[model samples]
Target: MITLKDVCFQYSADSTVKALRHIDLTIQDGECVVLTGESGCGKTTLTRCLNGLVPSFYEGELTGGLLLDEKNLLEMPQYEISRHVGTVFQDPRSQFFTVDSTDEVAFGCENLSMSTEKINQNIQKAFHNLRIEALKDCSLFALSSGERQKLAVAAIYAMDTPVLVLDEPSANLDLETMEVLRGILQELKREGKTIIVSEHRLSYLMGVADRYVYIQDGEIKQIWTPRQAEELSKAERKALGLRSFQSISLADIAKEGAPAEQGKRIEGRGLAVRLDKTEVFRGLTFNFQWGPAGKVVGITGNNGSGKTTFAKMLCGLLKPSEGALLFDGKPAAAKERLRQTYFVMQDTDYQLFTESVRHELELAERKNHRPCDMELILERMGLSQAAERHPLSLSGGQKQRVTIAAAMASGSDILVLDEPTSGLDGRNMQRLKETILALKKQGKLIFVVTHDMEFLDGIYDEVMSFAQKIR
Candidate 1:
């Protein structure tokens, strides 16, 4: 069992950010508890506290009673606590220490000084349980984000800890992979393991979670049993800034309106792209019409199917091996394409260079020489309050929104956003939808590369699937 009595923490004594406050919670063995809340509402912080990453690694002031299996976790070393409680972070790339998948999975076992036979047995059991035998010899860097996520979970599984905590495990995964994750969680529950997940995506967990805990503004606001959670209406959930507990399909929510007729046209002839000796795509020919009255195009495919590579080509970040790109019935040069395109990368941190949100827009405008109302843009994106906050200080979702806001203010004709909704909740997704629609009305061409079916269905007007296999 795990218990927290009046737990509270802050990053600094003088900092205004109260990360967590007066939290009281308990979890029995075999319980699956999910933590849900708006971005920056302390869900991640609470998880850090539970895993001993809080006062141990990150500099912070802590005051709380944290007990794990009747032992005080506050007094235990981080390494000792890690043996009993394993954590899978949101970004799997950050936790990986080895080059190959098999070695990465066996790392935790080796750290615990387990015998070679036991380590090998645990590795085999973990891979079998996760159904990922094909990934055993793959290079960690070569694997896709979703594949890396599976490896992260496998590594923790090899540890065979009694308690596991995962933060946004499904954020970067496709639907099929998410189903696999759900199955794994259910199997873990049957083994009498304690599971705690901090996530914004709630639909996949509806079947596996036994309880739901909702936090707001650094305090526990609500706790619901599975039965009570199932009774929540969509409207009630929306009002509370929560995602839908019931699964929804794209066809159920797709817009019914007809696509606009007037827009700028982009044509590709015999398009082919090759990265080193590996071919990504070839013999592709298509015409895309986009503008102020254009459709939002969704690009999707399996991992390593060149969805991102194609987007990069369209934005002039990469030159196609063989192809002719025409913009508005004229051949477009790479320089011209680069001038007109704005890309919001999958990792928002790479694109955000400015200190403050407001200044980021200013820098973007200076580069494009386009006048924009920064204040109005911030207000529309629900980031007016964070205008003065450093971009790095904000939560993951907030940083993504800031990047989008910058792209919108850049006055670019073509905008490509990769995985924009990865960490967003239902409320924030709606806000992003509104922003996309507004941009479309202004005649900007928008391309979204994502695996989020719900998000694509809600906003995109056209779907362009890349089904060609890589060679």
Candidate 2:
């Protein structure tokens, strides 16, 4: 259904630094194709080419031809190309320019001039097909990470495009949600939709993939069938740059069957938050205590259910609008909060403003009056190799760890991280888990807001969930 012939692309005017080179591939109807590559190895660029974004949205030199059916995608207008090929981006927030879930799903169909009734029908169909029927009425900001991901897929599927491309669909999903998505893909396959996914979670896609295409250094290194992928050994797979999976849990590491019960690290008595006339959350009081002096706390809920808001409140970045926040049974304010707390924002770029990774941690140390033994933290996070590199040039996992190291090195007694594992692989997730545990061992309180329950398992002493409060 789609083909790329002798395709080459460059992101800059230089034309020397090619993002993709001489790429040749084909995707038949109903085929489930998996694209694998290291960070910055052109997986995203190649996929962007399929939708005519290479020379359109991205400024680059393009050579050779890409054909979707009989027409060359390189020559077609981007809008025309999108009609046949739908893309779901790595970050769902990037695709959301609408308010509610239903409007978001129907937005694309409406633009295509589909009838109102037809658009509505497709919206409902998409909702039911993805098992997110209840989410149709929710605001886009109110959905969970998993729900947003499902909605993004639903929106793309509603377009009824013949070719669907997803960039790392399982990046932020917990194991259970990942399985649901895999089932959805299987159903989509049965409907004969051509699907191409760029994923680092090979374990999740292991048996589901019909074909594996590995890209390295802007070129296709190998293309293999499912059987071929299965035959490869662990070392051989790593050599092919495939990321591995871990079934080990924190329980296994601690050799404890169950986590200890949490007591009360931070207690908010009758706390409430209001924005203007609207109450975000009211009369909601909770207590977080150390299960052990060194254990993690995982806080998660439906998106916009105030996870970030609550994180900010906990870290003193946002005031409670109403109540008193207590730390260890004492009243807390900015000065006290700063001495004990540090928050890692969801987007690390928002917090990262340093030239090199080393300097980034150094700045955090200076600001917090903490020790500057950043090398030890870097080594713990497996970021020593990229210690001197520009923070922006590092991969998502590397950048996340750099932010984490900065937070840890700040010498705060409490650390609040928002979606720290959003874009990490299994190996990197394990590494991050180890780092968190190390911090926990030091009697530092770790509060994480994430959808990655695999990492949360056995780590969290308490799991706090929030639901939208009704008036």
Candidate 3:
């Protein structure tokens, strides 16, 4: 069993700010507990405490008892604590060290000095359990974000640790891949491993979680059993900034794109991209239009199906090898497209370059012919409290929103957001939708590259898919 008693932690970077406050919780040997909360509400910090990374990896002032089977986890060495707990981080890229999929899976077991044959067996078993055998022996860099997440889970699964912690494991997964993840979690729970998950997308955890622990502003707000979670009305969940309690599938989301009323149009004729001598997509003839109450088109496809590549192409980050893009019936070159488009990348770390979030938005605002409401944008994106903080110093979700606020300030006609809601809570997702709609009124054309079904509901004006395979 794992227990946290009166645990309070303040990061060394922000001495006056406590990341976690009075966190008291317990997990039985085989319980599956989910940490649910708004963005930056201390869920991730608490998970770090359980894994012995609070003071070890993150440098923080920690006070309180964190015990695993009556042994103080805070006193244990990181390597020793890792044996009992295997963690799959929010961003799978952070935890990966190997290039090959099979090798990555074997890395944890190899660290235990297990025999070569046994390690190989464990690797194979993990891949098979996750139904990711097709990903075996593939290059990690070549895989999609969701595929990399699958491999990350497989790597930890091979360890067979008593305590398993998965942070937003399904954040980037497609509809089909998410079902696969759900099955794996259910199987792991049946095997009696104590599981803790920190998530913004709660629909995927419905049947698998034994308890839902709601956290707010660095404190535990409420703890609910599965039945209680089910009993809560949709409005109640919304009031708490929680996502859906029921399961969601592709059919539950909007799949058709809405026709815009008299707006700018982007036409693509026989557009194709070739990377490393491989065609990502081809024979792509399409026209997309957006107008006031600006349309946010959600892009959905299987892992490695060229969603990000397409987003890059639309935003002028990459040029099409064949044919061209026309804006409002005029052929637009890469340079012109570059001038008209702004992209919020999937990895916010690559896009955030400012010392402070406020300064980031201010710099972007200066680029626009007209200025934006910086304070209002900050409030809508839920970054008002962290406006003066460095973009890199914020939580993953906060970083995601900061990039978006910068995009909003850029005053670009076409905006491409790749997985913007991956780390966003329901309330903030709603806020972003409102912001996008508000931008839509200014004649902005937005394309959102994502597979988040819950986020797709009641927001996006259309749904676009490159779901078919291309050589």
Best by lDDT: 3
lDDT of each: 0.85, 0.76, 0.86
Task: Give model 1's TM-score versus the native structure.
Answer: 0.93
| C-alpha lDDT of candidate 1 relative to the true structure | 0.85
Estimate, for each residue in 66-102, the C-alpha lDDT of model 3 and write its tens digit: 9999998878988899899999999899999889988
Candidate 2 lDDT tens digits, 8-54: 88776435467888999988878999988765578878888887778
Tell me how candidate 2 scores on lDDT.
Answer: 0.76
For candidate 1, the per-residue lDDT at 273 reads: 88
TM-score of 2: 0.80
Order the candidates by TM-score, highest first — what do you get?
3, 1, 2
Worst 10 residues of 3 by lDDT: 254-263
lDDT of 1 by residue, 29-86 (tens): 9999999988888888899899999888766888979999889998998789988999
Give the poorly placed runs of model 2, Cα more than 4 Å off: 13-17, 142-146, 174-176, 202-207, 227-264, 268-293, 300-309, 319-324, 352-366, 371-402, 456-471
TM per model?
0.93, 0.80, 0.96
Q: Against the hidden true structure, what lDDT does model 3 obtain?
A: 0.86
User: Which 10 consecutive positions of candidate 2 have the poorest summed lDDT?
Assistant: 248-257
Residue-pair clashes per prediction, in order, are 2, 4, 2
Candidate 1 vs candidate 3: the lDDT winner is 3
